[model samples]
Target: MNSFLLALRASPLRWLLVPLVALDLTLILTRDGYWHGLWGDTGAAGQVPTLFLGVFAAAAAAWTSSLRRPSEVAETLGAMPRPGPQAELPRIAVVLCVFLVPYLVGQAVCFAVTASSWPPGFNQYLGYLLLGVASLLTATGLGWIIGRLLSSRWGAAAGALGWLLIVMAFDNDLSVVNGPARMQPDLLEISLRAAAALLLLVACLWLPYGPRITRVSPLPGLTVVLALVATAAAVGNPVIDERHGSRTKACVKGPTEICLWPEEEKYKPMAQDVLARAENLPPVLAKPDAVHSLGLVYTEDRRWGGDFDMDSGSVWAMADGLTMAISAETFAACREKDFKGFEAQLKADDQSVLALERWLEKRLAGGGEPEYREEGMTESMAKAVETGKEMADRPEAEQKAWATATVRNVLGKYCDR
Candidate 1:
């Protein structure tokens, strides 16, 4: 214990860890709020501390391992009655604690701040935290082994750069780490990755270090085999796990209930206002009070520019979605019949749907002509618009009945056929 404390006090690398950890924490705090309250953002934020810690930890571990080369510590320790592994345990423990303490604290703080507002999936967050710890262990262990074996003056720089490149190239792109947009990695993937990292750490720790010409250690070889197996388990499964968090919805009550995913709850009022505009249609055309629900689907399409806005295009899209939902519900009554040969019918249905969408937009804009025009106006759509205008000229009751029937026919027989 005394020797460990003295070693720690003597090592300049220990002092360097403080500034690196502070920098990592600063980065995490600054970016944590940028994408707050969004699905997958929490796990992504959790990765920030790991990103900075891994590089510094690897470099520091290498430097620490190199310190023994200039001294008689290893020789003196070997001459003692105690075993080499047991004697060296304190130094290894100290180094690991130095790297891991900041990581654990930073992650806990990040999770706390995010959970207060965003409330992410606990299981997923825990899995990512475990993965981060395993990653740090792997990097540090590898660096320590390299330093011990090579004793190169450039070992620290090489360790830092090499680990950083490997992490950036693989961690962000691999599904086992961040997963794809709108998805989170499966528990199996996280588990396998964590296992592989730990196995590699074990291999680094157990493998004998020498100047040249050595036989392989059985423990390290077995660890390498197990690590490969764990990696295979991660890479073999090709299916991207769909994110259930995105489907988890919270609703706000109004004339029409506005349902949105929790990440999109900020736009509930905007969605309510849009639905209230939708309520202005004729009784039959308006959504029924019994089944009055508007589910907002948020798209990350570049054209949409992300999030709800008062822009004409965005308003039109929201109004269009309301009309589409109504049409879908109206068509549900006609599902018993089987329709075939739907190629032309599908085109006609699209035209009709677009016409209805345009009509709804005009109504929502207070019966004025739409200020913005949609691109790619098809000929069939123009004909449908003419037909819609004719129907609008009819008596109010007749117009309502015609609109309901058209939606049913188009969605049920026309689209399906």
Candidate 2:
């Protein structure tokens, strides 16, 4: 313990820890709220902070490990009354603490910032923290191994670059973009990553302390295993169920109750206004049923860029949720035994559904002719629009009945005999 503390005090690498942690915290504080709102998933919100910590932690570990290059002091320590691994354990413990303590502190600050807005369940938040800690531990192990194997001058740089590449691979993978896995946290993926990290750390512990050997070692076997497991976990499961199911939602009451994901609570007023607008549609045009709630999911694009504006995006998302709610109700009332076939028909007639959406949007904008037309107007859409105009020309009583029937028909609930 004395030797470890002495080494820490003497090491120049210790200085890097503070800057790295400060930079990470700065980045997290600046962007977490926007990310949380954009993804609407707390697990996804953890990615940025974790990625930053992992990359720098790996570099710091490598720098620390490289300082121990097979010196007389190392030899003297190894030659002590204790076994080599036991003798070296305290130094490793110190290194791990140096990297981990700052990381955990940064995580706590990030979590506190997130809690002020999203307030995720305790278990879910802890799970995210654990996932991040596991990632940092894996990076530290890999960095230590790399530093021990390579020259001190180049080891830290190599570790940093290698960890960066690994993170980029996960971030920019084509499968992640094309598939359902949009960088959100999944239990299966996190578990596999943690397992791979553990194996790598174990292998690093077994790494020889002296001169490099020509013969193949158990390290190669461990490396191969790690590679295979990480590859299989990343590529094999292109999609896994996200862990957002456990998140608690905050709700508000009005003519229709509006419930939103925790991160989206800041936009509750906007969401409510959208709902109020939706409710304002004439009952004859399509009175929405009792319930209303927003389905929060990760979104790739925003209507605006720069300075984290969520107004347009949140309003549009709320509108989409209202449309889906009405559709769900219509589908539930559907008597068609072949739901698949019914769904297929509904999709085919989506233009009519979209026309209703356009009409609703226009009404929300204060009942004027829509300034722009939706592109690629299908035959069904044109017919629906013409029918809507004809209904508007009819008497109030007849128009109301027709509008209700039209909405029901569009939703595939009331089929003509």
Candidate 3:
């Protein structure tokens, strides 16, 4: 323990101070960025501790590098002729502690702070700590092993790149969090990956020196554990296929545990309903005669943002009233033979109208699906409204007349009114 601490203290802790300070500054400045628009937000401070991890990795890499050529301690140990396999245990234990304990503590602190405002019995923050520990250990271990393989210089650079990629993968919104779909990995997978990386590191450290081994093979043990754990995870994965698209590589990778965005058409019915109801819905959902402006309800609150998912409590709270109203409008428009006006309405309200248009154009250029059905707005009227939105602008009077005519046609044909 003394030796390990000495090693850590002896190193250039001063160099890491810059990044640690910078990370803290960034966290303080970006407090609002981490919010999910919920009761208790994580705020950017939640990620502040991770900065220590980066500094630790960099420091550990440099420290581990010095061990390559025998040190004064190694020389003294060599002189002890009959050194047992257990003799090196202290240093190894110290290494493990240095790599793991402090990071875990930091993560725990972050988790506790974030989880405080959450509902009682929710230990997600603890889970995050465990996750963070697993992550850092894995990364540091990999860096250690790589430093052992290619000179420490190249290893540090590689480790940094790997860390960046991992962060990018996590921030990607398209990936699913908990599912049996493709294109994303789960927390379990991430831990497994980390474990695998640690094993690889230990193996790299001990395996190269011929048969007179000072260490028990880490690979065999890790492999067995990983195989069993992975099999169990795959067997017990609960996300249904319908909720996720065909399983993709992202689903299996560590940290990305879910598939990318669900197949677009799966939610078509729900989307149609929202559009249909929204069109004819009175501004005030509680009262029938109130003319609620669509912009005020959807835009002001950012109800259409990709944030509030179907299963979320927020979505549930707003759905019955909001979705119902949106659905009515879309349905009413579709029923009215005013296809043009219907399209225009869709264009006006669709959260992803521009994106869809761009996507459509790209798809057409690439010979992909040109006629895409939106899962967010499902009713026939919503679909028509979406179509109108795709067209160039028409005169306001013409648009209004067309909308009225379409409504009459819908009433006469579909409602038999």
Candidate 4:
């Protein structure tokens, strides 16, 4: 291995490496599967470049190994190769080109057949190219080191395994984007992080290979493994734990609470207070239901947890909130003739109302608390209950008038103060 490294160091091929690496990288960045899926709308559009990168990286690894094989070493030695970094670098460069051509050709086909546009422009392409080259070179270097440490075949196997692990861990949303073409680019970040870790692993595998021949070594390969593990821990955390499917699942049970799916009727106004206001100036107060019908609205097109709980004082706080949110959306959709937009708004509003109700309920249920005073006419009713028991012997009409006056006074205070 040392002899091979020295030979490579002495070869003229070294300078060609930079350009070959750049070419392969450019090819990968330009290929996009833009229209490959259904409707050409990719929820997973971000991952196309990473997929190409992985393929290129694997091919580059294999080609590099074949070029650096022991047979090549023997032949180079027999030819009395010039002792300079120039000679071997050219061979590495040639190998890189050979590996790159087939990969680039496939990408060309992918581009032509799909007629896809690289989502970003020249600057973005350059950025992706640089990123791809860095990742591939790192993998190649690591594969070279692994081959050296574990005999050629084991090294090749290690390289292949590393590549496979990276591709698998790229965060492809197979579970969701199935059956139709729904591409997403969200996994790109994860793929990039995985590729980076692979590169580090390659570095780790190679850096110690040169120094271990003379000194007593304690597993010269563990450094890369540990580094890869740590990177995975940091970059992979959010991807691994994300509850992607749960975004559509039912999470909210009541009208007053928010969840992915809220329950019915919790927000279906028993009354028609859709705007949360009083109407009917001819003197009767508008029914509370006429304005404050509970319902959920889908605002901003961002799917979130259903409405939060509002009717907490009731035995079924959660259920009530969920129910209200769903019903509200349904009700709004039915009313507006803009069924789609109405449903969306109702869901959002249900979420809002439930939140308000739950907050208010919490305030009302407290002790010596100011919230109790603000709970509409509940205080007045309690006072009425005490006074009514004392006036139990009064005639019905007199009692009714007195009660009416008291109720009007209480509700009037609520309206005025």
Best by lDDT: 1
Per-model C-alpha lDDT, please?
A: 0.56, 0.54, 0.39, 0.37
Which whole-number lDDT from 0 to 100 does residue 208 have in model 1?
42
**Better structure of 2 and 4 per TM-score:** 2
Highest TM-score, which number?
A: 2
* Candidate 2: Cα lDDT at 412: 49
Q: Per-residue alpha-carbon lDDT of model 2 for 1-417, expressed as tens digits?
A: 687777677666568678767775676666524434333234334444656666776787676666645588657876789765565565566667766776677656656654655533444444455566666766787677777767668878988887888767665321111111112445566566667666566555555564332244676656745754663364344323433221565566665555654544556676566667665444534334333332233323632111112323335445545555555444444436654545565656655545455444443433445444556766887876655444444565674465566576755443333
Q: How close is candidate 1 to the true structure, as a TM-score?
A: 0.58
Cα-lDDT of candidate 2: 0.54
By lDDT: ranked, best first: 1, 2, 3, 4
Q: Please, what is the TM-score per model?
A: 0.58, 0.60, 0.47, 0.34
lDDT of 3 by residue, 175-235 (tens): 1222111112344644554455555444434333221223445764465345435433432
Model 4: per-residue Cα lDDT over 1-417, one tens digit each: 555556457544445456544554464345343223211222222223434444445444543443443566556644665643333344444434444443344434434433353331122222232333433444454444444445444555666677657546655321112111111123355466556655554434333222122232454446556655655553444432212222232322222223321222222331122212112111221111211112333334564223333321122343333334434542332344433543543554423222323322222222122212324534544554334344433554564455445434433432232
**Which regions of candidate 1 are displaced past 4 Å?**
1-7, 32-40, 66-68, 115-120, 168-182, 209-240, 244-248, 253-258, 261-417
Q: Which residue pairs in model 1 clash with each other?
A: 342-417
Q: For all candidates, what are the clash counts?
A: 1, 0, 47, 80
Higher-TM-score candidate of 1 and 4? 1
Better of 3 and 4 by TM-score: 3
- Misplaced by over 4 Å in model 4 are 1-84, 106-135, 170-328, 332-417
Cα displacement (Å) at residue 157, model 2: 3.7
